[model samples]
Target: MNLLQKPILFPLNEKVRLIQYITGENSMLEHIELSIYDIEPGGKVSYHEENFESCVVVLSGKVTVDVLNGKIYSQLGTRTSVFDKVPTHSVYIGKNRFYTITAETKTRILIAASKTDQSLPDNLIKPEDVLIESRGSYHNKRYVQTILSDQDTISDKLLVVEVYTEGGNFSSYPPHKHDQNLLPKESILEETYYHEINPTQGFVFQRVYSDNRLLDQTMSCSNQDVVLVPKGYHPVGVPDGYTSYYLNIMAGPIKVWRFHDDPEHEWIKDRL
Candidate 1:
């Protein structure tokens, strides 16, 4: 099957959307899952872990997360929006856990999950702890914030991060792929990009392809759209006047991020 077919993008609607839930059950993916929640003020949702570990990222607005029936509770501060250029907040809950989320205001949240057997305690990731770094150079430069990855916290099979590509800039550049488990070189991983374009009507372009060219696709993505990378060299570009924010969720046999740049475009690194 074509790898591009793995990516399922959904336009935002009045109800919550489960891109992963709709695509995962029938796709080749076995590790990662994702869902989006659009809640109004005073709205609440309850959850009980069912053999998977999950990380809830508040894309916008304030929220109170109650875990273990309130045994561990926290009221997370708010971000005006993902495009606000500020660090966001998140909470990670382990397998078989129970939790509830109540919104203090209109909000949007992304919940990414991966099956695991490890029993780790639930924890909150504060804005102060989010590591923000600038990568690439010139038009390729973009900001990356590590949310739940190996560098931030240990996880059994989940890696979460967010990236901001300035208008007209590029991200996940130099065209890289992590579809082969060649340790010390590249590790196989399945990834998903949940995008939110600033201005709501703006859009971005993402290309996913394989070395042999057997699977290739260039997608025009807009707000709340999702793109999945089962295996390929994926890169994204934002148009002028439209900043792009994408929450990346990934999983694989290994917990580390090891990728190989497309040799044809590796030369671009010298110019950066």
Candidate 2:
């Protein structure tokens, strides 16, 4: 059966230059820009504003991230990811100018910040604030480098965070929505879920609006299957058994999210 039948996804077959900005698809939450990114062993992504709340996840090597505010190389989460929401200029010093999976991507999602996204509060949590959360699965009770999570300290200009649930673990269980303005503390942030399931087997279910029929999408994603949730009340359903994970890149008008449940399954919330 076909698993990944969601939105549009563009793949890269080659490497990117040192300073290049490639546009990504226009998702509901924000406009995206993806690049392969090259650092000369001791180079940094443009010294631009933390504008756009960007994220850099190491796919295959090591990077020493440094902030200008006396915050030296804070964390070395090689084989993991790092996130920073505050406004600060960063410099990434790599081991060499060789080729490894390093990505520089920006998200347009914002909350309580100017559209230009050029504001900082002076002192943010130290580089130590940038912590790496593992996002992988366990095989035979042995850990495998599958999934990880690294969230920013500011909790403002959010970027992408990786989440890996057990192959059969149910995440985002009951269907829900983030469009309810009434529950600002609950349902307010737009989301974009990029999936990576194990063995590329099994399927994930996501449902949007429907005039008469449910605009549901069942994706059996492998390496690259992206689903952009702009403004629909959505929920994810992981089948009975399947190791699953996704890089959830989100941003919106509000800082936090409180999604509402579908009327039919609203009862599940009480028991859960």
TM-score of 1: 0.91
| Model 2 quality (TM-score) | 0.57
Question: What is the per-residue lDDT of model 2 for residues 198-259, given as tens digits with 9 covering 90 to 100?
Answer: 54666666555522335554444443455555555555556556655555655556545466
**Alpha-carbon lDDT, every model:** 0.81, 0.41
Go through the candidates in order and give the clash count of each.
0, 13
Worst 10 residues of 2 by lDDT: 107-116
- Candidate 1 per-residue lDDT, tens place, 1-272, comes to 54333334353444333343423686667788787777677777677868888888898887888887435545675687887878888888888888888788777777888888788778788898788899999889899988877554556888999999989898999999999889888998899888888788998999999999988899888787778898999999999998899989998887878999999999999999
- The positional error of residue 28 in candidate 2, measured at the CA in angstroms, is 4.4
Clashing pairs in 1: none
Q: Candidate 2's C-alpha lDDT?
A: 0.41
List where candidate 2 sits over 4 angstroms from the true fold.
1-25, 31-51, 66-75, 78-118, 121-155, 200-203, 210-218, 239-241
